[model samples]
Target: MFLTIIVCGMVVALSAIRANCHQNPSVCLQAACPESWIGFQRKCFYFSDDTKNWTSSQRFCDSQDAALAQVESFQELNFLLRYKGPSDHWIGLSREQGQPWKWINGTEWTRQFPILGAGEYAYLNDKGASSARYYTERKWICSKPDTYVQMVQQSPN
Candidate 1:
């Protein structure tokens, strides 16, 4: 009877330890990004302080393995807005004036929040309004998927 109790206690202790170790599986996940890049959800974002035209900004982001920020959802748009200051920032929405807008990744623009004005490139102003002015120099935000590589533990069979 005493041996049975001892074995059960050891089993419970080991289970508790395992549960604690995996309380937050994300705690074991690691993401790699350049210095100064911000991590949110499963992505990395970089907000540039230097002003540049939309085309140039896109080039810079491409060099960094990212693209101009694409507001895929309201939550993402709000996240970008929260980081925005008093100045306008270039986003990934752009097209020939009077043409259907599209993201840098070639995705069609589907969101309705950023009602862009008649211009070739779109930007988000301090008021969270999205408008277009291709030649205007503005700060920019770049986003890319998280570079996290999960380390898998092998379980003994």
Candidate 2:
């Protein structure tokens, strides 16, 4: 029932943008995200309850066809911080010994959010983000773009 309402709302939204979908295909349609994942904007997020080391946390997300969450802006970070509850959850940020922090996709971390404290792997906590050794066991967040979304092209009569 809840999903039906969401689908109906998405259909209304997609109707407005369907024409432009050919140019910016990613945002075109379909809110049919995976069952357990939460759909926000153009991405789907999963917060795990089970604890694991950073590498193992990432591995679990990989099995779900997603990667550890990456924050692009303050708003996104806040959304994560708010929804992540009290327990800290691993994100996709990490650094090699004495190297720069990078996301799982290998993109270098920017000032989008500050990394407080000291650890090689990053996690979401009350303070937004904090570093911890990769082996530090904790819950994790996984995310992936809403690539399953697609617009069904109409055939001319």
Candidate 2 ranges beyond 4 A from true positions = 1-31, 147-157
Give all TM-scores, in the order shown. Answer: 0.72, 0.75
The candidate that achieves the highest lDDT relative to the unseen native structure: 2
1-157, model 1: which lDDT tens digit per residue?
A: 2121123123233343334447755534444566789876656789999999888999999999899988877887888888877778998988865678888989888866857466778888866756767678899999986653111122111
Q: Which stretches of candidate 1 lie over 4 Å from their true place?
A: 1-32, 149-157
Error of 1 at 29 (Å): 8.1
Q: lDDT for every model? A: 0.72, 0.79
Measured with C-alpha atoms, the lDDT of residue 133 in candidate 1 is: 73
Per-residue error for 95 in candidate 1, Å, reads 1.3
Q: Global lDDT for candidate 2?
A: 0.79
Clash counts for all predictions = 0, 0
